[model samples]
Target: MDLELYQVDAFADTVFSGNPAAVIPLYEWLSDDLMQNIAMENNLSETAFFVRKGEYFELRWFTPESEVDLCGHATLASAHVLYEHLDYDDPVVVFETKSGRLFVDRENGFYSMDFPAWPFHEIQVTERVAAALGARPDKLYMGHRDMMAVFENEAQVRELKPDFRLVAKVDGLCIICTAPGLDYDFVSRFFTPDVSIPEDPVTGSAHCMLVPYWAKRLGKSQLTAFQASARGGVLKCEDLGDRVKLSGQAVTYMKGMIVL
Candidate 1:
């Protein structure tokens, strides 16, 4: 079988500046094992697969090791493929996903994703957490999907030297390190050793928890975010009661065929 594959750089205007995700458009569902193997072969942060279903699409995301409930960069890459290469005429692409229905809207070269907010509550910071992250957090919160470590400044988020093994031992799906940004409203970095992603370049889903927290703290409904990974990303964020809007740009890196 020959499968069409597109690699897109999410949240970046130029190539190699953002998170890269492999997107595969399918007419029928592939076996879970096959998808997982494909994701592993791609050896990227995440691989996105989607199938058209009338007016909507069914979407799924897989990491190198396992499937995840939600992913922001891959979703953005999928939408980019639809708009730029697949001749998707709709202004909005609605996807039925494990996290529920997600909508990606395109306007003026930017794609905005509407995602459900993951609820977060205060959590105690333990010694293991401090040792794992190599810095003492000012505050900690446990979200439905991940655990957040709030720091005092952007330097703390950027200079983190985490012991991935220890981070995996703490709790939750991943560890999110965040702080007030220098130019933007806030900054963050995501690490998910447990789920196989040691560090994600630009994580859209992490903002689901970050937006609400920053909005409540800063007294603003709309905010800007910067993920301080090696290959960084910029995101326009809005807190909408129970939902979050994440907007960014994407550029196609490459297009090729995968033969199996």
Candidate 2:
């Protein structure tokens, strides 16, 4: 079989800047093991697979090692492939995912993703977390897949060096370190060795927690966010009552065929 694949750099206007995701559109769903092997072969942070199901496409995400419940950059990258490569004309694309229905819209030069708000609750910082992070957090919270840590400022967020092996033992998807940004509303970094990504350059799901948190803190509905990973990415965020809107640009880096 021959499979078409698209490589997209999400949350970036240019290639080689934002997080890269492999988007594979299939006629039918591949087996779990095969999808895992594809993702492992791609070796990106996440590989997105989608198939048409009625009016909406059913989407799934996998890392190099395992599958994940939610992923932002890959979702955006998939939408990009549908619109730019597959010649999808619609401005809005809806996807049925494990979490639920997700909507992506294209406007101007940016792609906006409507994702659910996954607000976390505050928690007491444990010594294990403190040790792994190499510093104590001012505040901490727990969410479905990761722990949230609030830092003093963006400088601290940029300077953080966590022990990934130790962090893998703490549980959840990964740890999020965030602080108020000097230029943007906030800055963040995502670490998830458990999912086989040591660090994600730009994370859309992480903003689900950040949008609401900063909205309450900064008292604004719309905000800007920067991920401090080596590749880096910038996101425009909006806090809807029940959901959050994450907007960013994506560029096509490569396209080819996978023969099996």
Candidate 3:
């Protein structure tokens, strides 16, 4: 069997500056085990597989260890592939995903995605959480998808040196450390030790909760976010009550054929 693979750097203008995701467009559904193995082989943060279903596309995201409910960068990379390489000509691209129906619209060079705004509530900060992140958080929120640790400044968020082993003991899919940004509205870093992603370069899905939180706190609906990783990323965000809009640019870094 043969498969086409494209690696795209999401939320970056040039190559090697953002989160790179492997995208594979398929004609039919491949076995879940095969897809998981492919994701592991690629060793990226997330691998996306999509099949055209009538007028829409069916999308799935997998990490090295397991499949996830939702992923933002991979979804953007898939849309970039369809529009640039696959000759997908449509004003709006719709995808049926594990989370729900997602809509992507292209304008200028940015691809804007509409995603659900996950709800989060305040949670007591425990000693284990403080030990994992190497600092005690000012506040902690238990989000539907992850746990958020709020700090005083962007420097505090950036200076974190998390112990992944200890992070696994904390409850949440991932630990999101965020604070008020120096330039942008907010800054964040994502860590998911259980899924084999120790520190995600630029996590779009984490902004689902961050946007809403910052929007309400800043007293504005439109906001900007910066993911303070080694590669880094910038995102234009908008809070739409129950939904959030994330927009960024993606560039194709490499393309090849995978033989099995």
Candidate 4:
């Protein structure tokens, strides 16, 4: 059989800049092993698969190694596929995911994603954490899905060269390093060597944790953020009571058939 596959650069207006995700538009759910294998074969940070369900859709995300609870870039890429490739005419598309209901809307030329915020709390920085990061952060925190390390400035966030082997031993699925940005309100970098992603170019999910922290610290509900990965990308962030809004642009990089 042949499956439709699309590679999209999420949170980027142009190709090859933002996070790249593989999107498979499925009419029916495929087996877990099959999807996982496909994701592994695709070898992107995340591969998103969606099956249409009435006006909304059911979405799942997989890395090369395992399935994740939530993923921001792949979700944006999926929405991009639905709107741009599948001829979806709606301005807003809702998705049922492992994390719960998610909504993506088209506003102007950008795609705005509404995601559930992961509440995080400050944690004591340990020797192991400091060793893994190479540079010790000023503060450390843990969220529902990731551990955050706050640095003094953007230079600290950008200059990081983490020990991936040691970072994999950390308690969380991923580590988020962030600091105040010069161009944007805040800047961040995400590392998930445990799950095979050394660094994510643009992470929307990490911003769920970043947005709340920065909003409370900066005393603002709306903010701008940049992910300082090798292939950097921009994100517009907003903090709501129990949710966060992350807006960015996506473009299709490639489309082809996957034979199985």
lDDT of 4 by residue, 8-109 (tens): 999998888999999999999999999999999999999999999998999999999999999999999999999899899997999999999999999887
Per-model CA lDDT versus the true structure: 0.95, 0.93, 0.96, 0.94
- Screening candidate 4 with a backbone cut-off below 3 angstroms (N, C-alpha, C), the clashing residue pairs are none
On residues 1-260, what C-alpha lDDT tens digit does candidate 2 reach at each position? 99999999999998999999999999999999999999999999999999988778999999999898899999999999999988898868999999899999999989999999996899998999988888888999998877999999998889888998898888577899999999999999998888788889999999889899999999999999999999999999999967999999999999999999
TM match of model 2 to true structure: 0.98
Candidate 3 similarity to native, TM-score: 0.99
User: Compared with the true structure, what per-residue lDDT tens digits does model 1 show for residues 86-194?
Assistant: 9998989999999999999999999999999989999898998999999999999999879999999999899999999999998898999999999999999999988
Tens digits of per-residue lDDT for model 3 on 111-193? 99999999999999999999999999999999877999999999999999999999988898899999999999999999998
lDDT of 4 at 179: 98
The segments of candidate 2 whose C-alpha lies over 4 angstroms from its true place after superposition are: none
TM-score of each: 0.99, 0.98, 0.99, 0.99
Task: Tell me which residue pairs clash in candidate 3.
Answer: none
Residues forming the 10-long window of minimal summed lDDT in candidate 3: 189-198
